[model samples]
Target: MAIAGASAQSQTYVLDKGWEFSQAGSNEWMSARVPGTVHQDLLDHGRLPDPFYGMNELKVQWVEKEDWLYRTVFTVTADQLKSDAAWLTFEGLDTYADVYLNGSLLLKADNMFVGHKLAVKDVLREGENRLMIRFRSPVEETAPQWDTDGFNYPADNDHSEKRMSVYTRKAPYSYGWDWGIRLATSGIWRPVKLTFCNGAAIDDFFVRQQEVTEQVAKVDNQLEINNVISTPKEAQVKVVYAYGEQADTLTRTVVLQPGKNSLSMPAWIEKPHLWMPNGWGDPVLYTFTATVSVDGKEVASREEAIGLRSIRVVMEDDKDGKSFYFEVNGKPMFAKGSNYIPGDALLPNMTGERYARLFEDIRAANMNMVRVWGGGIYEDDRFYEEADRNGILVWQDFIFACTTYPHDPTFLKRVSEEAVYNMRRLRNHASLAMWCGNNEIYEGMRYWGWKDKYSPVVWKEMTEGYDVLFRQLLPELVAANDPGRFYMHGSPYEANWGRPESWKIADSHNWGTWYGQKPFESLDTEIPRFMSEYGFQAFPEMKTIRMFASPEDYELESPVMNAHQKASIGNFLIKKTMALYYKVPEKFEDLIYAGLILQGQGMRHGIEAHRRHRPYCMGSLPWQLNDSWPVVSWSSIDYYGNWKAMHYQIRRAFAPVLVD
Candidate 1:
């Protein structure tokens, strides 16, 4: 309820109104809502004759050179400004944005997933201040080359086929992917907050709890602070951490002389309690509060809720081959989970309630992990908070979606900004288990002639370029900021040249049935490490279908809808299925029951195959558990959010040392 990790004095300004928009380099402008997409405004005002028809075409032509400018004014009292540093933060902006304070550039960044913040120290005035922002949508030039392995290209075909062709390219949506929507907005989408701080401010802090022995826990704290005052100040930094009913508090005093300072604090807990995944036990989260005070007056503070547990992936060899298994504390544990996409495809509009419900459903299904797929935006703080509270481990992916994006200087710069910003925002959450570099980027690159594919000169250059970026630049960036967590080079790609020695897991995404061949039964006989992704889909519940369909149309819709229609249904299904999976009857009850049975069988087979292979097969996370936009493929649930039989099958399959 308190908007975790936020300061009490912080004022949330809704920059959801009064935006002026225009095409880039053009003088003509129109007024629109700050938090709404440009397409929505145009449709609502009837600016376009057929709002949905040729939407992507219009988006490509109009959005490329257009920039949406959002301007707003807010006044803060001098008293409030004097005590704490005033900071302006955007929860999210689409593609790219350049923010200005009274026409003075504050921050420039790309990648719609991460939030941005700027210090308004020198730019703020006592009475009123103007904040203007310009958002540039990703242009065709920003798209990767046509021949690039993951690049989706336009086919020479009729308009009817154009929609289907969009998915062939690697760009996030390729224009018409089912889970994707073509909407661009040049204004702020998420909430904007102004925080006032005093003395030294808590910049960042990360807590790592290691279960050294059954009775002993080693906790390490990394704290960073910025000293705003000129004179030296003696301050006490105390960390009070609690797990369930057990709590441990430690305090240390340090002398700070202006500028910046970083401190590491280590503490020991005897007979510390462990956090169990949902159903295993209560999700005992330790509340960590670090307070910095000068002369007993609290100057700055930071708080985080974390679970206390040690997790490691070990390679084991069995009769089948090498497999990967996760060791928690000291015992082997099976991971059951789903793949997650950004809460909303329409940038920055996801609500906290949405995340909460999703986590709750995941727990109800006996899942303990959620893989945040790479194609979507990095999740917000609220997402991590819910996962932490619910004992859900997060496998986070970087923003490099399905394919290779442009390696141009501008695009590279934007990628770096996105990386740094996301790392800074979500690094401290305890729920984050690992950071994956990209999803299938390397595998796709292999098709571009990196290994056995056609070795053209241009293809070589592209492959080498991505290799350097992923193996070198991206890893370096992660090391500089997020050293405590684990990182996977790219999902489903084996380690090759330029890969870091610190890379921990061998991840794979096998689609033996949907993408390649049928029978879908080769996972038990393939390569090792973590079986990161493999899945099959079923239709969602009727209630979920109803959300998108009109009352009259709802009667016409059921779980047996064609695959194409299923793809149009979004993630709203995960929520709809929660009630049904718990036996709460809704509309089309018979269809929901039938779908779940089919899904359950698929999950049982996949998990059984994965478990038979161990040590070499550290874990197996299905292709997806929920749908961002409902189409039928690997997801266990359909677009309408109905539980396929696979959902229950997964729960039983992932149970450790299953008997009978």
Candidate 2:
């Protein structure tokens, strides 16, 4: 049987046309476009018959009970198949998918954040092939029960009443919210492609460079291979790597004959030039090319570029508490960067250019790290490449957001696939630093039940179920796939009874002021490794705010057009601090500067208070560094992409001169 195809060489294909879709349970047919949302299409045709009614207009209730099907036809030639092996791939699907090829079920996957691929060798014909997929959106009925209360009803209620299972209740705004949009059912939200490759393909690869010295550096390459043929065939694996202008190169070779083979190859580089961040020198990258050949014919090949560096997060025990610090290349360094949300709520809409610009901005700001918030999708490959090239470290979080997730078999399977897929895809990048199991899920448990303070049921569910997934499942998955990196159970929450000690470092998310506490307070106290979130929300610059608000909007005391305005003023103080760095010193000096000065002083005092109490506190990544769609956030900048005075204050605070 011919496994490879000529068309396989071109993995990119237009999947935008010929998609037939409908609401999950409705028999009504609707014409839709791939890589688009159903809501947008409905609006364009004025099919959205209702206005200002929450549940009526955005009724995705069908998705809770049934599946939405998408069908399309594609073709592959015999010659194309003979040239390269191919697999059908989906960049993303809403929540769950059951894929079919020529009416035969091929694969089922549940994670919306991770891509899925299925081997199409036996399913493909000489020409046309029918492709159909049934997607089931997340179970709407599974939302927390307490979320049904009108917008802010629970504000006056007890915390115990609010601690309801999200899976059992309706999502926030199911009754109605200001967004004026209804919930949407399933559709092909991202892109779909057919990727072709040769026999004994390169399934995945991870490179970790360690043991660096003046004369030589030790490198380890782990490659995963899928042998497609029934008869075992011997193959040779070769690796070539080079760094910098002096054209010296390093090479290593291994042999394999197998079904699924995990090969580890070690190589030595002579007089290796290390990759450093912007200020240290050029952010140099070492390019690596790996080729798998059968009888000298290249069967598979992959290329990756990585920086050689060793990083360690040291926690020192002192009388007061523990102090945390980061060491890169054996030298202590301060982590200065922003917390990143998804570039777009709609994952498919993000582009390579957008990723490049984000990295460029981080570089321009003279920052070294970016914390990928848990609320967003695991970014595409392009995002990691930009970070790798720019020498920016990534603090990665698994995708569980603000609340407790359902503990179902399907959920477990989905998270497992996500762990495997993302670990494989990004394992090669040197920029990836740490993997956090989830966001504030554990800590937020305390705030779940109103008045009751703590519910034994909710606590048991969170500790036993969610904790097991992270401590046992996720960590084991990463170790099997990519063993070099570290894993944290959940951000800011130490793993207790159910968690393993292997989960290194204690992290905390402090947002006392913004959520409910007083506006300002002294940070003269220390806590577990401080990773402050939900602080400072500066108004956008005059120019950026003009795009959304009037000039009078700039007045902090005036009634703002939106809640985002209030949030921005909160952030404006920090922006004022950043403005002082401008070359023209007098540019930011004025009576109006008083507010800006106060903002800077507060931020400095907060950061210094944590730093001075060292050993117990390691680093502080403020609530957020950027925005996705420009809602109310504690970001120092506004939606229009203008820096506020706080940006400069952050730069100085995170500067090596201070923390390091």
Candidate 3:
């Protein structure tokens, strides 16, 4: 549905066609897919083997070491080129890139997590224009930075030889994680767009829910308008709030300055319906349309949907330690869910349909929350939208995990920009619970023996860097941008899973059951204020395994099986624990079934134990809920979206009222 008031506001073109890519310095090019990667493009053109298949992952390791280039030709109208303001925007670029417009150097982008836009009116022409992007190999581009630092940051998850992921702003999992495949790929991983406007444009439009209740709801319709012209212009901003069979209108007329002008219009609605979480009430949403008109001619417009609700994290001190829980609408709520990794190693493969199915599975399994684990890309907008519609809360982590980063001014500035951009993009979502700094980074600083690996001077500098990044920079950014939302320095913030006293306080990631070889029964007794992470490994169902392995490759020690098991201790621990629970089965498929049962029973015990404690233990989010590959690891759902036996058991364990 188009906005009723939209007219000559702006003319935009999606530059997604006529794209091609080649190895840097090579004339041979292949038709490329935007919002894609070099690896996927290579495989699609039959130049490379399927990396996810058995042992073929080893064959495509050369792609990440070579730089790549992508180019496209787009046409623009004479009127568009004559506009007072014209801009080119790339919604995402894979790590290091240099963008050019019509052969003129335009911008250098270093972060994959944020969009980059530049004023290209002077560079763009009326006829055909060439746009090019050069994506430098992430490993090669960051190697010099690592060398200059003179000391290595401990990036255990990076499977690459140099471990330079800490020096790059790309998804850390692309370097490799315990559960993800190593594919440090590069390309134009998102859309490229061009826009033309005359007076001003809507930079951001948010319906800030100031106060909400059954009686009345107060809101401030905030608009950030960017004036592209040289002088002040008079503009009328009109906003219409619409719900089922109801609508309210608010209008403001103001003189916009040469640059960004912040404006807000306060309004109220009587008898407003509140947005509630899963198993609570309905998650009602209302839409708002805002239009900007200059001299009675509409210039820009935006439409957004928001939910009215209030949420806070309650952490008052209790007898054992500080209580950690989320308070929604003045009621303390228990979060029952699991950690979430990326749905696919190749991000573009995760489409809207995939996200819908994933959330549907989450709703069907009775999950109320999902921690978007750090290490993965900040998911597509479709993900959070689904969460809002399904009444599932989201725990978002800043994309830094399992490693320390440089605190140089240049590095910090990039991180700050990344933080602000993502915060602004996601702030209005009702499903967003809080912003966590990173995953396990704080714990790594305290308990991972990082200090022993460096001199006292180096250790002091590293520790101070951590404090600056997590304690000061990230929290300050959160306060400035999304003040109404909560921010945690990191997950398992005040607790270490290895320490006995840690369990009585804050959140905990109890790896003892799997990493420490502790029995499944230990989860029953070693409960915490919040069991944020704990799980046992399991193979995907036999059907999923058969997709990647041949009949002869079904054995645990086969080469094909080893290629799929990314975790160092994955196969060993599964076999070790299997012998303890049941007789080691001779049939390979039978053993796969047994592994699923073993994981299900272990997770069920932990989930039930956490729920049995009720108000004392407020959350139980297991190690993972889904997989990025068909492998033997800790995920209830596999990469093909097949539910392992553990998912069925988790569905039962997460019931609102579970007996025994």
- Pick by lDDT: which candidate is best? 3
| Candidate 3 least-lDDT 10 residues | 1-10
Question: How accurate locally is residue 638 in candidate 1, as Cα lDDT from 0 to 100?
Answer: 52
TM-score of 1: 0.78
- Cα lDDT tens digits, model 3, 424-492, are 888889899899999888899889999899999888888899899999999999988887788888888
Cα lDDT listed for each candidate: 0.61, 0.60, 0.87
Candidate 3 Cα outliers beyond 4 Å, as residue runs: 1-7
Displacement of the residue 517 alpha carbon in candidate 1, Å: 3.8
Q: Comparing 2 and 3 by TM-score, which wins?
A: 3
lDDT of 1 by residue, 1-660 (tens): 013344433333555444566545766667766566665455556564432222223433364346666666777678766764667777766646788897699987555656766778678888887877777654443434332534332221112322222222122542434434443334455676666666778878777554445687787888887777778888888898876577778889999878788989988878766776655666666788988887777777888876777666555444543445556667776677778765444443456776778787788777788898876667667888898889887888876654444466755776677788788778766567778888777766654343443346546656666776688778988888776566667876553222322123455666553343334344445534566776554555555544444344432243323322424332234224333444533564454555456456656776777667654455778767766544444566554455656766776887655663
Q: How many clashes (backbone N, Cα, C below 3 Å) per candidate? A: 39, 47, 0
- Per-residue CA lDDT of model 2 for 522-566, tens digit only, reads 345423454535354444444553444455554444443343332
TM-score of 3: 0.97
Which of 1 and 2 is the better model by lDDT? 1
